[model samples]
Target: MRIKYKMVLLILLPMLVVIGAIAAIVFVQEKQLAAQQTLVLEESLLESKRAEIMDYVSLARTSIDLLYSSGRNDEATKEQVKAILRTMNFGQDGYFFVYDTQGLCLVHPRQTELEGRQMWDKRDPTGFPVIQKLIEAAQQGGGFQRYLWIKPTSGKETDKLAYAVLLDRWGWMMGTGIYLDDVAAAKAKISQESDKRIHGVMRSLAVTAVLAILIVVACAVAVNLSEQRSADAKLTAMARRVVTSQEDERTRIARELHDGISQQLVSTKYQIELAQFQLPESDENRAAQQALEKGLDGLGDTIAEIRRISHDLRSSLLDNLGLPAALGQLANDVAAHTGLEVRVDVSRCQHKLPDTPAITLFRIAQEALTNIVKHAAARQVDLLLSSDRRSVALTITDDGRGFAPEAETYAQSGGIGLRNMRERAELEGGSLHIVSQPGHTVLLATLPLSEAG
Candidate 1:
């Protein structure tokens, strides 16, 4: 993938992970909270149901207060009280029942077949003794009990809550009950609504996370496009500079040949013509012989100068024997021309370089040496070439009166040469660097071996 896409992913992946974690935590916490709220609502509804049943039982007891408070223990009075209770029911599935202390059914408005049945051992589906528990609560004044019983309306076993009071004079337990199915329905509705809200929140979070990732991606793509344009501009400028540098080099060589070599050839040709004129009067003319010898010497010097210029244009050693021999020959030529001590070291380099990098290194070395000869006035110079499996490096160091590399004057004076050398290395996917102080200067160029043919 391109760098921009990679960067976008780098930003987006972590955000997605964090957002997903937050969503999960929120989902879990919301579910727990909904469960808790449902429990609280169910308890509240049960409490209301308990109070309502207690009120109904109190009203039934008050209706028989006049007869029971007269201290009567007659069976007729108990029968009259049972008749009133059988008719005092509030709604469908709501009523009161009576059981004697000996567990005999007396008043059961909902199921009249059990009016005189013995019911002491009656147990609910979960092994709870329903009549025994109600009697126990009534014996201890008044209290409540919870058990399952068949509902008249639905004819199905369901949870029920009852309040019971003891009628000591009649030797009976009387109580009323309310089923809890409404409270369960209410709790289930609340839970379903809570789940809907939670789902809505999760969807919103997902949309927000997607928008955030898209924004990051768009920004990365914009920055990448901008950088690409800038890089293309720089490449164009560098290409132009390279063309200009090549033209300038050709111009310099042409000027040297015209101004220096052309004048010497004219001088040598005139001396040869003068020697030919004196050769006709030979034997006694030592001056004519000396003139001929002088002409021959000048011709020899002219030929040597032409060969030096040709070598400068392109080194035969570089093409034939490789970079090491080329660099050694360059050092020897520089030392001979300038009387400066120059040493070439390739002892630590065994890897051979391909043409592009080899030529780049040679050109940078040539430029650095020319700069050193022209500006650096001290004694000795060293040219070191080293290589490893991955890359090759050429370092040129001089013990000379160095100038500040960053100074405006220094950069302006030799900026073209320095830039040319740097550009050459960069063109080969390499780099050039220079460091200079008062008595030391170093120019190092490095190129990758991976680009080699």
Candidate 2:
């Protein structure tokens, strides 16, 4: 596992996860909406049927009322009631019949067996519950109600929605009901859509996962032999042992010269300057003495420059004082060395974030400011590190003669410096932004705060 491919995995896996999650969410929402639309339309149609039935019953009641009042037990009233019963086929397993409290039938269209034979002791087996409800509503006033149904003929069950009203004082109930079969049919359609969406999303996810793996493998191949080396290219692999070993070596070398030869040379330079300053100046040795004095002066200057160089190369206090102290030292040193005024506000971040994230941020700051010092010719810099309960952001700004970042040189020239910074941020699920104008360049990095323990 070379680091580049691992870094590639670190980059692409999260993308796949995000795309998958979004697709799943969209699929679910779309199915729910489709199902909802089906149910709404179904209920609306059933309600229309219910209204038509109620109107039919109203006309039947009016027709029967006219028959009773006009003294005609005639064919016109019976024929009109029969017309109303025909519209109820939409309620699949439902029916309609009209009877009086005197145990007599006014109209029972399904009662070719009982149009004239009813004595009103009969109760509807399938329609009684709904009829009883309508009777109660008519007895009370007008209102909305519900009933469940199972038709003996169709053998299908339904949840019914209906509205009821009083027809008259003749024990007649006029009302209409909506069938829920349409609701079930719509649910079936939604179920099919859900199956389709799941299949599609899973197929996409599978292809994406497979593609990511292949891309990594291919990238690992392309990344190989990137630098030609005597028919045997030496490469750094992205494995645990190699990166860790490299870091250990860097820390060791940085510590040695900082603590060892630098201090010794500084002490030697001090002694030579002291001896030269104390020598006599009146002898023929005066010119030689003056030369020794100047030599000592040059040695002192050389010593100072070497120490400065060593300090810049590595900070011994980084390992000793940890990241926060190291960052403070870096800021101070940059201001002192570059002759730029720097204001660093890091109150919300007195401790390191997650160890790896902290290291990444530190390195980013180091590289960015180093570039500013070397090339920006900036005068003032502002570094802000603010943390909340969730995330922390580090921003570095320099008031320098900023250049156009739109040009390809901004990244291509820096080679892996910018690329490495980007990789660090992406690996940790964060982002980086760069903005530059005539006299200002700002670089910002953000990551979670509480990862360092």
Candidate 3:
């Protein structure tokens, strides 16, 4: 994958994992809560069932009292008891039964046919004191109890919750309860809801991670394209400047030869012919003397002009004497042209350097000094030429009315050609640095003699 994708994965993968874990935890807890709430709801339902059963049995005892007072405690009362027993599912999550003061069942919801069916000197469903205890409580004051391990049915196991109250007259005790089945249903529902919510959270996290990855890739692409375009534009501009400089150099050479040297040579040839015509052919001594003198004078002037042109075209001293001699000539030219004091320190450059490095250094110095003469308009210039086994460094500092290099519109134009000097150094795999401010300008060029020519 590209680095952008890698980075996004690095950042988002961990976050997604963490979110997934948190979601799982939340889901588990939510499931637990649902289960607990279901249990509570079931318990509440069982309690309501207990209350209804207790009320019916207590009302039956009141009915017994009413029957005795009205003298009808016979056939009609038994039918009423049978009807009450029919209302109970003896072993659902709920159960109910009834017993008299003699510890015998008057009505059993399940085995109602055995109406007198209990041995109730007995324990409650939880194995504690039951009918007899409630009767004593009714004789003393009144209170209730809650405990565990209650077994109300025989020949089978019954985990029961029973509430009992004392029978007042003929003696009776009653209670009702439901098993814990309802609690389990509530727990399952909570688990399902929690699972759904956690999965939802994980899905959301995954989406966010995907979005982050896409954003990173987009930014990386934008930066890469922008940088590529910028580099291409710089290269194009540099190429154009190189071509322009080459054409300017060719035109300059042509103009100098045509305007300065060709016309001078033509004029001199005409003058020599005129002198020949003026000389008398018969006076051999005077003619020979004047002709020889005129020829020597004209030739000397022409030779001087030719040498100047040659230097302008390419420093002849570079071919004849070496880099130092060429720089010495440059210093002389600068002093002559600008009326500025020019100084050169060539002691460090005595040991010859690689040819390309020497040429690049020379061109940089030549361009800098020329610019100082043409544009600096100051009194003094310092040129320091130095070299080592690895590289050569030349520094040209001018005490001049300096111009801002970055602001110099004419650097690539006619006024000062510093840009050309920079390109020359760069072409030779070197750098030229310029530090200029008001009243001071320093140009330092370092070319690697060990590497570049």
**TM-scores for all predictions:** 0.46, 0.42, 0.38
Model 1 whole-model lDDT (C-alpha atoms): 0.79
Q: Quote model 3's TM-score.
A: 0.38
What are the per-residue Cα lDDT tens digits for candidate 3 across 1-453?
987677666755665575567567756765675567567656655654454444434333332332333334465764564455446454444445556666676655655465766655566465676556544544453333443333334434444445555544434554444443344455566567756766775676578556645755566332224635865676667665654564455446546655665565556556555655665666534545454465546555654665565566567576567788888888988788667899888888756766556666776777777777777887888888887767778888989989877755857756328787787777666788889887889998887765333
* RMSD after Cα superposition, model 2: 37.9
lDDT of 1 at 18: 74
* Cα lDDT computed for each candidate against the true fold: 0.79, 0.61, 0.61
* Cα lDDT tens digits for candidate 2, 1-453: 887867777766665676678677767776776677567656655654564455444333433443333333456754554465544443344555554434444544333455555443444445555555555666687555666654445655556666655545435444545556666676677678767867886777678667756766676433223324622222223333334554565565455545664465567557555655765656654654655556556556655665665555455555566556667888898888778787877777755456556666777788888778777889888888876657778899988998775555765555245656766676566788888997878888987655434
The deviation in Å at residue 59 for candidate 1 is 0.5
lDDT score for candidate 2 against the true structure:
0.61
In candidate 1, how many Å is residue 119 off? 1.7
Better of 1 and 2 by TM-score: 1
Ranking by TM-score: 1, 2, 3
